[model samples]
Each structure stands twice: as structure tokens, then as C-alpha cells.
Target: MHVENSLTHYCIPCDETVCCACVSSRHAQHQTADLVEYIKQKKIDISKHKIQIAAEHLPQLTKELEVLKQAKEVYQISADKVTSKAQERAELMKQVIDLVLDSQLSEIQKVKDRDLDTFIFRENEICFQIEDMKKIVADENGGENAESESDFNIISAEREMKQKLESFSISERSRPLPPKFIQGIDDMIPEISRLLGKVERVGEIDGGVTQRKSAAEVKVQIMNTVSCAKPGHKVTSICQTSSNDVIVAYNTQKSIDFIDRNGRKLKAKKLQFETQDITMNKKGDLFLTVNDSSLIYKMKTPGNPTQLYNGGPYKALGLCAQKNGNLAAALWKQEEGIIAIINSGGKLTETISYDRTGNKLFKKPYRICENSNGDLIVTDSALKTVTGVDPRRHRRFQYNGGTEAKNFIPIGVACDSSARIIVSNWKGNSVHLLTSDGEFFRFILSSRENVTYPHALSIDSLHRLWIAQKEKVVIVKYLK
Candidate 1:
């Protein structure tokens, strides 16, 4: 639609197909080329542009083709690898099939050999019994009214063997034997039956016969662990201090010793008398509950102590600190069974007792922690259950030593801020985790070299388990 003006000399420079007559006349000398020649030059320029565009596209097309070729080669390599692996597996399967067939044939041959042994044994035993009977009959013919005691013993032994065969037959009749196995055993049955019939025809006689059943023996392989030195005392209680040092109380020595993380002994003075269970309170105070003693001792500082709880006819097995400034203890009473609760200043705040279903807090209980909106996860060693009691005094979760539960005897209980309950079972010698609802998570297997006889457990701020054991203490970080 463009037209060249008079000032412009070339139509191409003006980008026009035609120019006005005055423009053509004024530029006649500047552009004297013919119109047909101009058209030819324009066509040449168009061809050059087309060639440039094609050259630009060629590299891109080449790059795309190279990429496709690489992808195809990679796929072919992976396919070849997979096919080779499948062929190897098929060859291994064939070898295993051949081995199985050989094993089966060998088992069949063993059965045949055992059947032949059984037939021979039965025939020899029958012949021996017949010969003994004939000897007794010959002795009677020699004018002996009473047979010798040896003859009577032989008869008694034969009778016992016959009775054993009869019992075996009776026991075997209820179930149908495999036809192949029964066919292998058929040859000995006739001779065995004939011997039994002969023994039955001998009639009843009095003889002192001793029937002995082979005792069943169970082989238990007990590998005795020899780790610690032979201390002059037994470990009465174990506790961990704030500095991660384990304190083991010995009853005979009447002392507590500092133990390293590797269960190596350290020099520490013993606290006096039968230390049964030891625990540490929030103020880093060491507390010891003496067995069969009414008083509990608290060490404000190391080697300096004072009696905290006196005037009590109870024995404490476990002690823990509540979130508040109170002490929770598992106490055994003469009249009542073991009860776990927090006794603040000799006043019971929260008491837990069991019913028929082993539910704790079934009765009305008060001050069960308003901040903690979940159940009171308590491990009962006597009842072998971990009971969960809601704040409203309702039994919400219960896991016991039933066929379904994993724990055997739960002794200690500790809960995290996230309401994950950790329980240590004395029988299992391992720690178990339970959700807030008492469902099992998994067991923490005891590291034999470091941890053994785990009796108590607590979770730290970082969710790592601080376990209390007999010989040493262990800390395990739980992974999310």
C-alpha cells in the first residue's frame, strides 16, 4: 500500500512496490535499472533471507536429534541390564529347583531305609519273646512249680513292650497318615500284630514291673555375661545423677558407688543401710528408700543427708518427681496391695488403685493435672499393665500381659511433652513406647554391651531416653 515520494530515488529503500510518476522521473538517473531486473534482484535477496533462516534452524534441529539419540541409547542400556538380571535369576531358580528335587529323593530313600529297620526290629523282638516263652514252658516241664524271677522279669518286660506298641497304635489311629508313608510302613504291621496277640494270650500274672517314660529334656543355652567385677555386694538400686553419672546402691556394702557410662566402677562413699530404690528429685537431690525401713533419706548435697519421710509402715519400690513440687512413689502396704501416687507433705494428692479389670483411677480422684489434658500413664508391675487414666477419673487406655500385648511386666512409666509414654518392663528387659492412647509403638532393644537389666526409664527434653539399669545407665536419642 506504500508509494514512493519525489524526494526518494529507490522504491526498495522506500519499501514500496511502485512510485509516483514525478518520483520516477526525478530519480531516473539514480535508479536507471529496469523493473524486470529490479524484480530479479528482489527475488535473490528473498532467497538469501530464506537460506539464513534455514541455517539458523539447522543447529536446533541437530541438537534435538542428538538429545533423542542419547535418550534412546540410555533406555537401551537399562533394558539390556534388566534383561541380563532376569536371565541370571532364571538360572538360579533352575539350580534351586534341581537341589530341591534331589533333597526330596533323598528323603524318600531315608524313609524306605527306616521302614526296613522297623521290620527287622519287630521280627527280632517277636522271636526273642517266643524263645523266652518256650524256655519258661520247658522249665515247667522239668518239675519246677514256680518259675525263676528272671523268667518273670522277662515276661514283664515283654508285656511292657507290648503295651507300649498298643498305646502307640491307639494314638496313631485318630489321624489319617499320608498314603505314601503308610504304604512304606505296611510290611511290619502283620508281625507286630501277631506278637501282640501272643502276648494277650499269655494271661494276667503278678510281677513287679517298672514302667519308665523317657523324660523330655529341654536344652537352654545360657551364655553367662562376665562384665563387671565381683563386687562384695549385689546391686540394690540404680539411679542417674544430673551429670549423667550412674549411682548403684549395694545392699550388703550399704553404699552407693559412681559408675561410668561403660559400667566401670568409680570411688564413692556408700550411704548407710538397705537401699532398695534410689531416685533424684527436681532440685538434684538424691533420695534413697531403704528396704523394710519406714524412713526415706534425702541427700541435699553429696555425703550430707537428712531423713525426709518417716513414721510410715510401708516399703517404697519406685520414686518419681511430679511436675509440681510433690513426690510420687510406689508404696506397698500390708493391708492393701501396691499403690502409686503423689504424697505431698505426707498428704495423698493423687491415688491410684486397681479394680477387677486392672483399671486405675476408677474411683473419684482429684488434682490429676489440668495442664496435662491427657491420661495418667502408669506402669503397674504387680498387675503387669500400663494404665491410662483421664483427668475426669476415667480409664481410657489399658495394655496388659495378654496374648496381644508386647510387654510382660511393666515397672516404670514416663511421658514426654508430646504425650508419648515410655514404659520399662522388668521381664522383657527392654523399654516399650506407647502412644497417648496406650497403643504400642516399638521396643527399644537393650544394647548388651552398654545397657543391661533395664529397670526404669525417662525421656529428656530432647526426646532422648535416659534408662536406668542394674549395672549402668544408658541414653538413647529417639529419631523422629
Candidate 2:
């Protein structure tokens, strides 16, 4: 309605620029200021902000962009490498198939060569018999006037010739039937497809950090501390998002909570039942394992969680994210336990029950984590030991705490960029470091240093460790 009129004044009450017509209309009672002055002030503010951006934000963003580009380059190189490997496997399979094909063709040639040998022999024999018969009729000698009337000898010769013919005859089944090639390519497609192997998209590396301090040179110090649990809520699990926000799961209260970096509270998602373990996927969806139900649930950010899987009678006791963007869920039933490997689509791809020598791998898997080297780190709370399994499904080592830590209760497990495993010793009230090969390195933190009963552990991109102990979640930076 005011498109035809030019704005000249700013209405203070309405907080909008007004034309001459607006002055006598709804904006007549409101205080007004010169639009030209307001425009000047806005320009001044924009210029000031532009200077701040150039001095502060632009340089930081440029560096961040460079880091992001490097990450992209790394990802592409890794993908190309895997693709070449898969192609090599396919080429090898093709060569093997060609060998099989040549084998069948060679067999057919063998049959042909064998049948031709018998046929040639029979042909020569029949020719000789025909020559003998010709002699019976005449020409026993070179001249045409030999003995030409011998009936008894002719009858006896004919009987003997029939017996010779019978020796060269072949049985019907013994005769070759030309081998036909039927469809054999797609018979084991499901199995043959697996031979090429899957292209696993490993989990992302936040901020592209790939370095860590050695055990001997590490300095442990508290970086930041946050508390998400209420007075009586028990913190069962704690994990970090890509943005470094904390997500805590409560088993006693049957709820999941979130908190941002600035200590501001985010929207908390409730749960229908208590969960023992919780994990976040690459897609930012949170997964939790209910203690009583066999169902595993996935929760979208700022939304409710729904059922993502059912593990039959073996309820999931622990959940963790795999480096291949898959999920590692530990389930227990009937005093036996197994770790189920699930893909991103919520389908169970494989299950690990026994090691290479057919020995039981675990009886109770409490908490699980996947290392950067594709090894699985699982804590068996029942046995009070940690099992390290390699990618080949071989149990590499079982780490029962050292002599000093007799009653070790390993609760949460995590790994740094160098594959150094950090375990929270709940009973010993310390955090222990283990080499990538599962050998004991040293204790990084202990209750003597004010770290009491470390329950869950998480290492972030900045090399900060978030340890959940009691009602407080403490962030520790052990890497120098």
C-alpha cells in the first residue's frame, strides 16, 4: 500500500522506516527519527564489524578452510587406494575363472582325442575284414582264377569276422556326449561379491588431528569440568559430538541429556527405559542399549529415539561406534556374550563369538570401542579385563591389570590418534595407558591426583580427555 511513497523517517515504536503517508496513519502516535541518520549509523556499524571480521574471523576461517581442504585430500587418497585394491581383487578373480574355463575345454579335448583313437583302430580293422571277404569271393591269388567255391570255409570266416566286429563296439554310455556350457557365473554371486571386499567408510577425524604425546612425555592436567547429571541421576555413559558438546546418558533416571560448550543446557531427550551404554554415529544419531530389552534405539538430535535393532534374547550391554562407520554392540545371554557388528543400515553383518583357535572371546562385554587401526577394544567387566581383537578376528591380547592393580574394573575405553588405548580403572581410581599392542604402558591419572573413580573416557580432536566420574565430567589434557 505504501510502495508509491518514499520512506523519510524511522518510527521508534514500530521499529520500521515510514513514508509521509505512514506519519498520518498507524505511525502517527510513535516517535520518529531521520532515516538518513539511521542509515548512517547502520553503515558505521557494518564498517566496524567488517574491520573485526578482517582482523579476527577472516584469518581464522582461512586457516580452518585450509585444514578442511587437507582433510578432503586425505579422504580422496584413501578412497582411491581402497578402490585400486578392490579392482586388483576383481582382476585376480577373473584370472581364476579363466583357469577353470580352460580346464573344462582341455577335458573336452581329451575326450575328443580318445574317441578318435578308437575310431581309427576300428576303421583299419573293418578295412582288413573287407579285404578278406573279397578274397573269399575270388582272387585268393594274384590271378583271378584261384579257388572260387569254398562254402564251408566262407561260413566259418563269416562267423569269425562277426566276433572281431563285436570287440570294436562301444557301449552307449561310454560314447562321448558333447559337453554343454550352462549358466554358472551367477550361481554364487552373493559369495563372490564378498570376495571383492566392502569399501568401508571409516569414521571421520575431527579437526584432522593425527598426533599424540608419548606415555613418558605426557602431562595430565584438568582442562575443563562439566556436570550434566542432577542430584540423584546416575551417569551411565558420556560421549562427545563433533562440536565438542557433551551427551550424557542416565541409567537410574531413564533419560539422556545434552550440554553445549558454554555450559548452556540443550534440549534433553527422555528415554522409555534405562540404558547401559550409548554411542553416537557419524551421522550424529545417538544409539543406546537398553538393559532389559533386546532392542537397540537410535535418536536423532533434538528428537525422540526409535528402535534401530533387536538382538533376540541377547540384550545389548555395551555400544560403541566403529571406525568403518559401523556399530559394535556387545550382547549377553545365558552367561555367554558376543559382540555384534552392525552396519550403518542397522543390519547385522557379522558376529564375533570365538577367536581364531575357537576359544571364547568374552563372557560379558561391558563397554566397547574401535581403534583407529581397526582393532576392537572391549572391556569385560565380569572378568575385570580388557580384550583387544585385531581386524582378522584374532584375539591379540587380554589385558588384566598389572600386579599393582589386582582388582581392576575397566569401565570405559578410548584411543588416541596414535592408537594408544586409554582405559578408566574404576576400582583403582586411575586412568591407565596401554600400547597399541595392548601392553601396559603406565597410569596417566590416579585418585592421588584428584581423579576419583574414572567411569567413562572420551578423547576429542584437540587431544582433550573427557572423563565422567561421579556427578562431574572432567576434561583432561594428557598429551603435551
Candidate 3:
């Protein structure tokens, strides 16, 4: 008996071989293509995939694997050195009890084992991924199935393999293994000696672990004041541009002056209305609010200003930019004020007018800032408090100068890189540092600094605090 041609055609949907009769009988409505033609296109696709894997994906993964291997080696070397040092110290203390020595050695060994296990597990994981990727490249090059595999089978395999390779590419972007082991035995040296009975009491690690500098550790010293603008111009707001140039907005003049680090006026832009508040966005564009209208204008340069927000009934008093490319405007209507978050196209995305309890949130919101954690920090001038609102416009907490912050009257608000909210006191002539959640941290600048009329506050890229006074700009180095 003669066998029919069963693999004359390919069913694209079912991904299988089919004869002429089967194509018409079962897969008549399905997409069918010539087996030879399908195989030809699949071969081309497989060739391109192989090139991507070899030229791009494999090389990157191989580099990452090498890095992981080197890290593992370093970890092993450090473990060996720690173990050897413990042994030498134990040998020197010949009169020490065997039980105490063993305990000390056991502690060292525990650290070594734990770190090595983590390093090895990470190393093996990278190695396995590398090998799997290599296998994919090899399979795409038709490892052993080149001769007999059907076209449908080849196409299906290539699709699945490409997905896995793409997934590997994505995983490489966020690989979690640290470049080197950071934990060390330096903290355990004294403890090890005391545990060996060399002293009557047990010793603790001098510094258990490395810690970040807290807000309390930060100290501020007034560097110097520079006359940024003209004599009669009152500094209304101050911000640092992306080019590290300080820009000061003046109330008396319809202009904003850009000053360099050495306090030289580099450029100035004349505005139509007196500048009320000015802030720099991440793109280095300036957003300014005028005293006359409710609109906010975005100025890429001095003369060319485009209206950003012109909708709400309240007049814009202060302007600030969020990290997500949204602008926060302190809008005031008579005695009540609201923090409105506007998009780039001058549309309001959210408004912070009321708290979760349906109570009004702000009395007179001015000088708005967004913290690193997405909380809006507003200086409520009327209430004499600084309030933090969540992304959902709910009140997180409020700072009313507490007992130490007498006569607070917060005016300009800014959050530093360390997530500390710095609020300038209008009447107290000092600046208060609060935690991001509005808890009172400490006074960064006290009234003792001889600061008079501290109004607008800003934190520069170097973590230096900039205070806008009457006609001068004060720069203070508050963080190292």
C-alpha cells in the first residue's frame, strides 16, 4: 500500500503538519501555508534570532556571569582570610579555654558559611541562566532536530525560545546581586577576643553595621550672603537650575536674575507682571506665578513664556514641580487655599483641599514642595503650620512649630535629598527641619543666625540650603 503525502501543508493555527485531504477536511477554515515556504521563512527567522542571542543577549549575560564569578571568588578569599585570622589569634592565646576558643571560632565560621552560601547560590543561578541561554542559541541553530523536525514544529519552537530569551534580557536589567560582599568581620574582632575568655566580660561589636547619616547628624553653617539682584528688589523665590546657576525671583522688579556660584549676575528676564514665586522643573524650565492673575506660566527662557495653568478660580500664589513631571500650585481664594496638581498641558489632575475627615486642609497654602516619597509638603501661612498630604490628597500630618518652634509662621517649604522637609519661618527668622511625614525633627537654622525676614527656602543639588532674604540670598551648607 502506498502512503499519502501527510506533510504537504502546514496549519498555522494548530502548528502541525497536514495532508491535502486533511487541509480541506479538518483545517479548511484555518490558515494553511506551503510546508516548504513556511520552512524557508522559519529558517530566516531562526538565523536572525541566533544572531541576536549570540551578538547581543549572550555577550551581556556572559559579562554578568563573569562579574558574579569574580564576586564569588572575592567572597571566598575574604572568608578564608577571616578564618585564618581567627585561628592565628586563637593560637596566640594558648592559655584560653578550649570551649571558649571553639565558640569564638564557631561564630566566625557561621558568618563565613552564611555569606558563602549566598554568594554561591547567586553565582550558580547566573551560571544556570548563562547555560540555558547558550542552549537556546544552539537549538535555534538546529542542534539535533534540523533533519526531521517539521516546519510547524520549528516555527513554534522558535517563538517560544525567543520569548524566553527576551525574558532573560529583561532579567539582566534588574539583576539583584551586589557587585561585592559588603558585610565584614571588622565589627566582630573585639567580640571574638572577649569570647575567648581573654577578658572577664564579653565584648560587643564596636559598630554593628554601617548606617546612613540621620537628619540630627546634619549641621548647618551660614556660608555667606550675596546680593543677587538690584538694591530695591526683594527676593521672592530662589532655585538652582540644572546648570548649577542660582536664579532669584524679585518682587520689586518684574524680572528674575540668574547668578553664578561666585554671585555674578549672568542673565535676567523681564516679566509682564511682578514675579510672586518661581520654581525649576527637572528639565530646567522655570515655572512662575505672577501677582496679577490666576495663571501659571512656564518659561524656557526670559522673554518667551507659555501659560501652563489658567483654569481654577483661585489665584496661583506658589509653584513647585513634582518628580513625576506634574506641577503643584498653591492656589488661594480669599482666606482658603488648595494645593492643585496640574499636568504639563495645564490640566488639573488632583486637588488637595480637604482631608480624609472632610475638614478643610489648608488655610493659606504657600510655597509648595513634593517629597521623595510623593507627599506634598505645603507651608500654611495662616495656620502657622506645615502640612504633609499624601498622593491621594489626604492629610498625613501637620507641623505647627511645636513648643520649640515658637512663632513658626512657615512661609517657604523645600524637601532635601535626604527626605527632610525644610521650612523657612517668616517671623522667627529661622528654618525648621521636619521628617518627611511632618514630624518635628529639629531646627536647622535658629534665630541666632542673625537672619532677618527669612522668606523663600530652597535646597540645591549639593544639599546646601538657600534662603531668600530682603535683598540678599543666603546659602548654607547643611549636609556633607
216-297: candidate 2 lDDT, tens digit per residue: 4455777777777766665778787856787877777777777775446686777788878888877788888886668898
lDDT of 2 at 80: 92
Write model 1 residue lDDT over 253-360, tens digit each, in one string. Answer: 666777655456676765657776677755777877776665666786465657776525666655655544566555665434333444444444444565446644
Q: Model 2: C-alpha RMSD to truth?
A: 22.5
Q: In model 1, state the lDDT of residue 421.
A: 69
lDDT of 3 at 348: 67
TM-score of each: 0.43, 0.54, 0.55
| lDDT accuracy of residue 399 in candidate 3 | 89
Tens digits of per-residue lDDT for model 3, 315-419 = 788888876688889999888888777788776655678887889999888888888666888888888888888755688998888654577789988888656
- lDDT values of the candidates? 0.55, 0.78, 0.76
Pairs clashing within candidate 3: none
In candidate 1, which residue ranges exceed 4 Å CA deviation?
1-246, 250-253, 259-267, 338-350, 354-376, 390-394, 401-407, 446-453, 458-463, 466-475, 478-480
TM-score of 2: 0.54
Top model number, TM-score? 3
